[model samples]
Target: MRLWLGLPVASALPRAHLCVFIPISERSRKDGALSLAALGTWAQEQLQRDAGAKVRFVSVGSTAGSPLEPYTLHVPGDEEVGYKRLPVRILKIWHYLGQEDDCDWVMKADSDTYVNLRGVSDRLSCFDPEEEHFFGVVHAIVPPRQLREMWPALYFGHGGSGYVVSRGLLPKVGRSALPCLEDMLEMTQGDAMEDVIFALCLQRRLDVQVESYGFLRPGGAWDAQLAEQEFVVNFHQARDELLDRRPKAPLQRWLHWDAQPPPLHACVMVAHPVENETDMMEVHRKLRADAAAQVLALAPTASEWAEPERMPLGLGRAQCVPSPMALARQAEVRLSAAGAPVKAFWTPKQLEQLSQCLVHSLGKKRCGWTDIREQRYGLSYWPPAQSSDACAEACCRSGADCSLFQYRADEGCWLGRWEESQAVASDKVWQGAVKVW
Candidate 1:
């Protein structure tokens, strides 16, 4: 009984869920109607056949009350061309939905066009042809060879490569939560259009398939009439006219799924391996907020942490890990008996990574890294455990401090500074680790 109430057929789609996300510029729609002339009906036809298909038509626009500061961000240059930002935003929304809802297939495309539905359906249904799931495109943009003669730069474009994506292939949100590829591009190189660069993001960040659709019309784009007869999903202003002539939702005439579904109770979807990406950013977000509070408490006497450094900082020389249960004797310390103690060296790169992780987890603060020598120590952020509170409280009572963050593997907690009667290294194997007296 996981009851979710939404549009009809929400539950039925997951077995073969295909999500159609069409994000159009609200003002960009032609002729004063949310529906494009002749396009809406045909787009609907592409989806009508599948009872599980969910077609989400979204219009993006800035509200009147929005302030000027947001103008640059809200109306990025890409909006003028109806290029890729809105699609990115729409995918993000769909991703958020997938976390809570039950759609497994995601189809993102333009508003004014028609897709070849039957051709797409045939390609889609053939999940095991060359590969089970992949990216299909309608067109490709490529520069030409002899184009150097006249226009010199207007050659690289291909047609009939459709855009298709399956739901099971979504990218994991990073635990470290990397920047939007566009932002990264701006910092690395001068900014470039996201449409051209989006492919790179998919390959580098998400590592999913990004091949062109075998049945797409490419750059020239398909018109309403020929598109209807040739493909299952035809693009642009042609759907309504096509549907109007025939007058029926495709669901009435489509194929019924023959595969019997497994029982719903505890049915499992083996999470697609991120391979390396971590999306447990929520864990780090909380860790950061907590660390910020703790840090503020650390040097409250100072107005802010960013005061220019009068001197370079160090974590101090080596420390030692004392014998275990030593605290019981007289504020004893416990060292693991197994192997050499771990060395907690503070490299600048590691420090910066830690700081970024903290900032990412915690939001920007008035303070920055300090120049003080590392009299104090820090630990990696691990996810919280049930015993975390007890261990943290015990350490605190015993005069210790700690922090927790979600690692790529799982939630981990790191214990920090501990008082010792005899100085010891926190980790012994690393050189120069000794406990402070």
Candidate 2:
């Protein structure tokens, strides 16, 4: 039931405690809701529905929203640029760790990035609770062209997304976050991708082993025609139409901790009873604690886990999506990854009506969907790549676990003892090997 492979024999791991922090930078007034209050309301609406997944609405930047109870974030000015976002997200995770006692893991994601809860649960359900490791999107990040435009010294990758981490690295990351933040601003690229900088930070700094699963990849990789789904935390800029409102697949069944049932009986813990403000607060608090314990306990033991549900979609998942349609036709809209016009009319009344029946949404507007066997991130090893598996063979050959590094092909990735370099291959040839990963 547990997957902790390497250990010191005496090294001990407690239950995996986790806190999912959705770092959202809603343009204080982009939705034309007219005021920052409207932004908060819109964001909260999305955060509330997913209360079951045990996440918090961490509103950052200049948006003056309501009290983010049970959850908190840094409020920076709108004019802040180049790495400001990273510090805000870092500070939030740091604050949570300081307050909690049992937390063993933490996931920071984008608000728009859809989270596949069942997908995540299934992944989280694979632990043994006695190993040391960390997991997250090992973004297929390319180094910057110019030194100044490049990520800061401590940071290596670009904009991080919905990913997991262990408490082992928390103290180091938390302690170093600010210095890296200051360096980000100094670069003055004026770029605002916080995750990118964060990605680099985790890859280079944390000395622990990191695994990337493909079950976390959200929808864009989905092709109804190809039937190549397998994604969990769909990320990198997306839209509403890009979102599959359809009930892709269930990631879990009703979970019962009471039964010593299969340890893999992973359940999606939704924070319920968010009927009022106080209810929202309580639900948020309880969910956070529960997520912390669930993940911490499982991390050392579980082979893998991911937020299988579409990360309540936002710009995070959208920007990375290689959509067949134009950005204007995305399911949701906001500024582009470059902070340009990501707004569009897929939100038209007619589109809205179409959105209502997406199957994932039961009366909720622009609601996220479940993670099918397809549409996963770089966490789980099950769903073979619709695109890449260069590392899988190596991993299996060595009798080791595999992890996916970032690649550009529309395929999937593997984690745990994977091949290091990408071999040149054609699309058609690679497509045939999709299932191998």
- Per-residue lDDT tens digits for candidate 1, residues 89-203, read 5334433443434444455544433333322443343242223233543222333555534322211111112244454554342211135534543554424443334444444
lDDT of 2 by residue, 1-437 (tens): 32111111222444333446554445533212212231243234444343223445455443344454434444333122224445545543553443333335566654333343434433433332224445554333334446435432222221233556555566666665656656666764325466555655455555443343222212232232111122322211111112222245522222221111111112222211122233223323333343444554546454242242222322112121222111112323222222112322122432322222221222211211121122223232222223333333322322222332222354444332123324443333222122233
The deviation in Å at residue 264 for candidate 2 is 22
lDDT of 1 at 180: 50
Q: What TM-score goes with each of the models?
A: 0.35, 0.39
Off by over 4 Å in 2: 1-17, 25-53, 60-99, 128-132, 144-161, 185-192, 208-210, 216-229, 232-437
lDDT of each: 0.30, 0.35
- Candidate 2 to truth, TM: 0.39
Q: Cα lDDT of model 2 overall?
A: 0.35
The C-alpha stretches of model 1 lying farther than 4 A from their native spots are 1-16, 31-40, 45-52, 61-91, 94-101, 128-132, 138-162, 171-178, 181-194, 212-437
